[model samples]
Target: MRTGILSEVEDMIVDEVPIALVYNGISHAVMMATPADLEEFALGFSLSEGIIAHAGECYGIEVENGPGGVSVELEIASAAFMALKERRRSLAGRTGCGLCGVDSLDQVCRPLPALAPARGFHAAGVRQALGAIGARQELTRLTGAAHAAAWCGMDGVLRIVREDVGRHNALDKVIGAMARGKADPHDGFLLITSRVSFEMAQKASLAGVSALVGMSAPTLAAVELAERAGMTLLAFARGDNFVCYAHPQHLAVDT
Candidate 1:
């Protein structure tokens, strides 16, 4: 089971608070997320925001389990540290919501640069990856209060997984881990246990992964982003059927 403090159902209150990520003694953005996998959350946040190009850019990560929640102290490279500081300086703390803190509607729906078109991925392999994702979800299964993002290979091998209360956070964690571990994002597919959003699609593209599969629907913005990125976007993926939104040519559906 996922390691997290649990309260009985009906009495369970979702733990949400400001998690301040500090990089090389400089304060970065504060995210409101559940108090678990905080270290992963910090690294993931850093990667998704383009604060750190790779995991190795983070020299160290220290988690302080505090009263209200947790604080992540990250020792990042000088280059990434400067970028993080610039980002924080641009934010209006009072107006910014922790999860969706982009400048405007257009920024919120930023497009991903087009990538190499995907090779047709087998349906059976995709199904196997979906099942693997379900099995690896320790936190979500325990609290019924988390989202998961996984990186699975073309042959259904799950390379890495991350979980968070916020879907975006979960995806960030996965991407961060991949970058840190130097894993081959191009070797596999990306899967989410939540609906596909433009941000999610953007992150996947930035990670250079070619396909995304989700258990729910994709927003119109997300679909458009996937199309621009030349990535396959699969939604409503269930027992034997899935809706291919963009790049249907990349899916290996059977006769």
Candidate 2:
């Protein structure tokens, strides 16, 4: 319906499905996502949400497709499972909601250690990565509803990319892929196709990523957290222009 005109048309759209992340037979969280990378999403969620300390803590991951939706079952270490049981909060996540179903205000923000200093990032590299990322987003090209998160090297090369209907899920997939590939988070920066939110910044910082570049604007809380965590936060990245919200010193001008 365009301007009150009724028309019949068929279009390609991104898939948004409920993905249940079950840990040790306990259903922890269910998020609406693209459902392409269930294993990566499960690993990344567990790591970013502090459910497990590291990748080694997660012994195994199994993906199950059912009639209703997809389920990702994870087998974690006993210590990590005990910790998860002690502080488990059920999350009912939607596509656009990051903090839905939080049981308490205290659980809203998780504590993270300050990130190590990141160096050798140039503005030219940021622009180069931004330019190349669009072509790599196959799902976005097919369905405009998809969002992507990319891990780029300091030289602006795209190392890994993950896409989903939800921005958080994409980032989680990237994190999980990075872990699986043994990529060093501090040696590169994260590029996202969505606005910089506090949760997004926190997730990157938790993964020891020192910089984040976004194609949209950044929230106030995101800037403040990035500053406190010693992260380089850049947003509104279009073409050769971008706004550095925090730690601008890390982005050097290329000669």
Candidate 3:
């Protein structure tokens, strides 16, 4: 056993910490998330979760460290604050339970706004996106554990990329960045380095994203939801091919 003392290696684990969402002085929700791009995370969560209509509605944000983990305080408009209070918002909202508290079919099949049809995406472009996303993943390069979500332009160019240990958080950060940058949600497709879970689909809908492509397979529930929302869903984007779950008409197919 003494010989083992001579051997040691540096290791890396993805960073995660408690992110408290405080609205207007009330402590609302606490989430376990990577401590980066948090201002974007807060704004994106607000818009996607229907807490605020847009980034403008959020007045200010402050982040600090508490006894446990990181805390994010959001100052939103009076109208948005009233709406949040009306919902009896608690820790309202995802790793496993993307659709939590759903014990009924109606809740599971809740209505989603129809997304506009997406522009066709060529196979070559899909392949390029698959290849290109990996290079943009800086955190994953360092931690080897972060997931990335990218927004690809209609021309197959990668515009925005965000990474986190949680796939959903990565998506949120991207959305927030896009919103701040005035990127058109319907003008391009979203690609994530994670499975197409139902929450991913839901958040895409919230962000007005008409298309979603993932590097992994999509779940049956995700397919069903995509079909109803009128969003194009594609997964297993690799090589020169991908699988389409809904609205295959959106893929150019010729490329």
TM-score of each: 0.84, 0.92, 0.88
Global lDDT of each model? 0.79, 0.90, 0.83
Give the TM-score ranking, best first: 2, 3, 1
By summed lDDT, the worst window of 10 consecutive residues in model 1 runs over: 96-105
> Residue 253's C-alpha lDDT in candidate 1?
69
In angstroms, how far off is 86's CA in candidate 1? 2.8
lDDT tens per residue, model 1, 19-122: 88877876656777877767777887777767777777889899887776667899989887776666666665547353444555455644455577655477
Most accurate candidate by lDDT:
2
Order the candidates by lDDT, highest first. 2, 3, 1
In candidate 1, stretches whose alpha carbon ends up further than 4 angstroms from where it belongs are 1-17, 92-94, 97-101, 104-114
- Using TM-score as the yardstick, the better of models 1 and 2 is 2
lDDT of 1: 0.79
Q: Candidate 2 on 1-255: residue-level lDDT in tens? A: 999999999989999989998999998778899989889989999899888889999999999999999999999999998877766434333344446435567877778777887878889889999999999999999989999999999989999999999999999999999998898988999999999999999999999999999999999999999999999999999999999999998789856
lDDT over C-alpha atoms for residue 46 of model 1: 76
Better of 1 and 2 by lDDT: 2
Model 2, C-alpha of 66: deviation from truth (Å): 0.2
